[model samples]
Target: MDSSSAIHGYVAEFEKAEQLVAATRRTRLAGYRVFDAYSPFPVHGLDEAMGHPRTILPWLVFLGGLAGGVGGYLLQYYPHVIDYPLNVGGRPLNSWPSFIPVTFEMTILGAALVAVFGMIILNGLPQHYHPIFNLERFERASQDRFFLCIETKDPKFNKTETREFLLELGASEVSECEE
Candidate 1:
C-alpha cells in the first residue's frame, strides 16, 4: 500500500463501557495491540485490565526538578560570588543556607512544567480527528459509552476475523470504523 493510503480497520461499537472494557481485556490477553479507548469518565481497573504499562511521567518530573534545582543554585552562586563577589554581613561566598529556598522553588516550578508537557506528549493529545470518531454513535463516548479500537496496524487484524472475534467477545454492536 502507498504510504499516503490509510489502512482502515473495523470498529466494534458497544452500548456500555463495561462491554468495551471486557472486550479490550480479552483482546490484550490474546496479544493484540489496542490503539486507544474512549470513556465518559475514568474507569478503575481498566488500565490494569488492558495491560497498559506504567507511565514514565513521574520519573521525567523528578529529573526535571533535579536539573532545575542544580541550575537555580548555580545561577545564583556564580553571579553573586564568582562573577562579582559581594561581601555582606561577613557571610562567606557560596552560602548553602541562602540558596535553599530559591533552589526549592525553581525545582518545583521545573517539575510542574515538565509534568504538564510530558503528560500532553505521552497521551498524544490535541488530536482533532480519529477513525473511531467517524462512527455515528461514537458521540456518546463522552456521555455513557466506552470504546476500544484495535488498529489495522495490529499483527492479527484481519477485517473479517477481527469482527467475528469482537462479536464472540460479546460486543453489543460491531461496525466499521474508517479514517
Candidate 2:
C-alpha cells in the first residue's frame, strides 16, 4: 500500500485530449524524459507536447531500398558478365539496360518490406505486456479515454511527486502502474 515503492511508474487518466496534451507539456517542462500518452484517436500537437523527436524509419527504408537495388543489380551483373558470359546478339556482357527492371523491382520490394519490418522494430512491437495493463480502466484508452504515463526510468520521477503533478494538471484520476 506504499505509493513510494511502486517500481512501475505513474499514470494519469484524462477525459479529454486537451488535458492530456497540456499534462504532457507540463511533464516535459518539468524535465521528465520517459513518458508517453495514449488515446483512442490521434491528438493533434500531442507529439510536440510530449517532445517526441522524428522517427528514423524513413531513413531505414531508404537505405533498405538502396541495398536491394545494388544487390539486385549485382545478382544480374555477376552471373551474366563473369559466370556465364552470354554473347547473345553481340551485346556487351555488362548490359546495363537489361538489369534495370530487376533492380527497380528489388528496390520497390525492399522498400516495402523494410517499411513494414522497420516500423515494427522501431516502434518496439510484438509487445504483449506492459505495467500499464495492470489498470482495469486502461482498457478505456482504446475506447474513449486518454492516458499519460510517466515512466520510472525518467530521472525526475518520484512516485509521489509525479502523481501530484498529474493531478495538478487536471487529470481526472492518477494511479500508480505496477510492473
Candidate 3:
C-alpha cells in the first residue's frame, strides 16, 4: 500500500472523553480495530483501554545511548592517548575518569535524539492531510470534543456496517469521512 494511503478511517465525534472512551470500549468488544483517538487534553487510561501494544522506542533509545557512550569514549581515548599521548600530572595517558562527563553528555544527547526521531517514525508524522480533517465538526477535536477513528483497514470495517455501528454507540451524529 502507498504510505500516504495508510490512514483511511471514519471519525466519530463525542462531546466528552467518557463518552468517547465508552464508545471505544464497545467498538473493541465488537471486534473492531480503533485507529486512534484525539482529545484536547490527555485522557487517562486511553492507551490501555484501546489495547495499544508496548512501543520499541525505549529499546531504540537504549541502543542509541549505548552507541553514543562508546563513541564518546573512543573519540576521547583515541585522540588523547593513541594518536597523541598526553601525560598530564604524571597520570596515565588513557585516563577514564576525565572522560565520564563527555560520555554522560553524549549518552543523554543520543538517547534524546533517538527518542524524538523514533517516535516520529513510529507514529508516521509529517502527515500533511487526513480524511477526517475534512469533516466539518471535526475541528472541535482541538477545542472541547473527543474523537475516535475506526480505520477502513480494520478487518471488521465496512462502510455501511461501521456507520451503523457508530450510530448505535450513542454517537450524537455520524458523517462520512472521505479521503
Candidate 4:
C-alpha cells in the first residue's frame, strides 16, 4: 500500500471463461458484493453467478412507445380537428383511422430510440476513464483475457487476504488498481 495514493481495487486475470465463472461464483459466495467479471466474449450463466437481477428496460420501452403513440394521435387530432378543422374528401376532421400509420411509426421510433439511449445510460457508457484502465495489461481485456475485480469498497475487502484468495483461485496474475 502506498501512502500518497488510494487503492481502487484488485484485478485478477483468469485463463478461461469457465475459470472466471467459477471464480466469480466463489467470490460471490465468499460475500463480496462489490466485484465484477470481464470476458472477451459473452459467457453463459455469468449473470446468474454474479447474482444480478433482471432489468426494467422492457417496461421503460413499453412506456416510451405508449407515450409516442398518444403524442402522435394528439398531434394530428389537434391540427386537423381543433386548431384548423379540415374535412378532406368528405372524411371527418377527427378521423382517427387515418392517424394509425403515423402513430404506429412514431411508436416504433420512440421505443427504438429509448432502448438505445436507456441501455447506454443504464450501463454507464461513454465513460472514458476508470481505475481499471490504469493496469498495463488491461488492454488484453478486449482481446483474449478474462478478469475479475474485487473493489476496495466491498465490505469484506482486505487487500492482502483478497490477493491471496485470488491466487488460490488459480489466477494467472493479480494486479492492484490505484486511483
Candidate 5:
C-alpha cells in the first residue's frame, strides 16, 4: 500500500503563538474535533482554546494505588495469618501496623508506575513516524514556530476548505502532510 494513504491532513504554520491559539479556538468553534496544535513552548490557555478536556489519568492512578495498597497488605497478611502463622514475642499474626510501611510504599510505586505508563499509552508513544513529519516546516514546531494540524478523520475536514479556513485564521503557510 502507498504510505501516503495514511495521510492525516493539512498542517498550518503560525509565526506567533497568539495566532496559533486564536486559530485553534476558531477551529474548535467551527466544530473541528480531530485537530492538534504544537508550539515551541507551552502556550497559556491553549488547551482551552483547542477544546481539550480533562483526562482520567488521575483516576486511573488512584485506582492503581488503591489496588497496590490492598495487594501489599494481603501479601503480608496471607503468609503470616493464613499460610505460615508464625508468631514471635506474642504479637498477633495479622499485625496491621507492620503492614503500613510496605502498603504505603506499594501505593506510591503503583501510582508512579500507572502515571508514567498511562501517560505513554494515552499519548500514543513509541510512534516512530507521523504524517506531519513529512512536512519540512513542521520541524520548526519544536524550535520556533507554532502549528495547527486538522486531521482528515475530523468530521468537517475537507482539503480545500480546511486549507482555506486555516489561511483565513491567519496561518502564515499551510502544507499537506503525507504518511
Candidate 6:
C-alpha cells in the first residue's frame, strides 16, 4: 500500500486519569495485550486495570540475598576454620557470631544490587528509543496528559478497527506512530 509499513502503532489520548483507566480496562477485556499506558503521576488501581501479572523481581532479590549471605558466611568460615585456623582468642573456628555482621551486610548489598539490576533488565532500560517518542503529544505524558498505546506487536491489532476502537473509548485525539 502506502508507507504504512513504517507504522508502529496508534496512541489514544484521554483528558482524565479516569478515562485512561477505564479505557485500559476495556481494552484488556477486548483482548488487547501488547499495549501500554502513560500518566503524569501514579494512578491508583491502574495496575489492576492493566491486568499485569505480579513481578518476579522480589524473588530474584530474595535469592540474591540468600546467595550473598551464604557466600559471606563461607568467606569467613573457609579462611578462619580450614585455610588458616588462626587461634587468636581460642574462639571457635567457625566463629558464627562474627560471620553474622558480614553476612548481614552482604545480604543487604546483594539485595540492593539485584533490585537495581533486575529492575533495569526487566523493564528494558538504557539507551532506549521507542516509536512512542515520535509523537509530539507524548511530550505531555510526563506533564499532564494520559495516554494509551496499542502496539502492532499485539496479535489482535488491526489498523482500522483499533483506531475506531480508541475513538469509541472517547479518546480526545488519536495519533499513529511510525517505527
Best by TM-score: 4
Q: For candidate 3, lDDT tens digit of each residue in 118-158?
A: 99999889788777787788889889988888887787877
TM-score of every model versus the real structure: 0.85, 0.87, 0.87, 0.93, 0.87, 0.91
Error of 4 at 68 (Å): 1.1
Using lDDT, give the best candidate's number.
6
Computed on alpha carbons, the lDDT of every model, listed in order, comes to 0.80, 0.88, 0.83, 0.90, 0.88, 0.92
lDDT of 3 at 150: 85
Better lDDT candidate (2, 4): 4
- What is candidate 5's lDDT per residue for 1-179, written digit by digit as tens? 24435777889999998998889999999989998898999999898897667999999999889988899889899999999998799998899998999999999988889999999999999788777878888889899999999988887887678889989998889888875
Ranking according to lDDT, highest score first: 6, 4, 2, 5, 3, 1
Q: What is the alpha-carbon lDDT for the whole of candidate 5?
A: 0.88
lDDT of 2 by residue, 36-134 (tens): 898999999898998767999899899999998999999999999999897999989999998999999999988889999998978789888877899
> On lDDT, who's better, 1 or 2?
2
What residue pairs are clashing in model 1?
none
| Total residue pair clashes for candidate 3 | 0
Where does candidate 2 clash, by residue pair? none
TM-score of 1: 0.85
Query: Residue 126 error for model 4, in Å?
Result: 1.8
Stretches > 4 Å off in candidate 6: 1-3
Find the 10 residues in a row with the least total lDDT in model 3: 1-10
Better of 1 and 3 by lDDT: 3
Off by over 4 Å in 1: 1-7
Over 6-100, each residue of candidate 1 has an lDDT whose tens digit, in order, gives 64566666777677778878888887884566788998778977877799999999999999899989989999889998889898988989899
Clash number by candidate, in order: 0, 0, 0, 0, 0, 0
Q: Tell me the TM-score of model 2.
A: 0.87
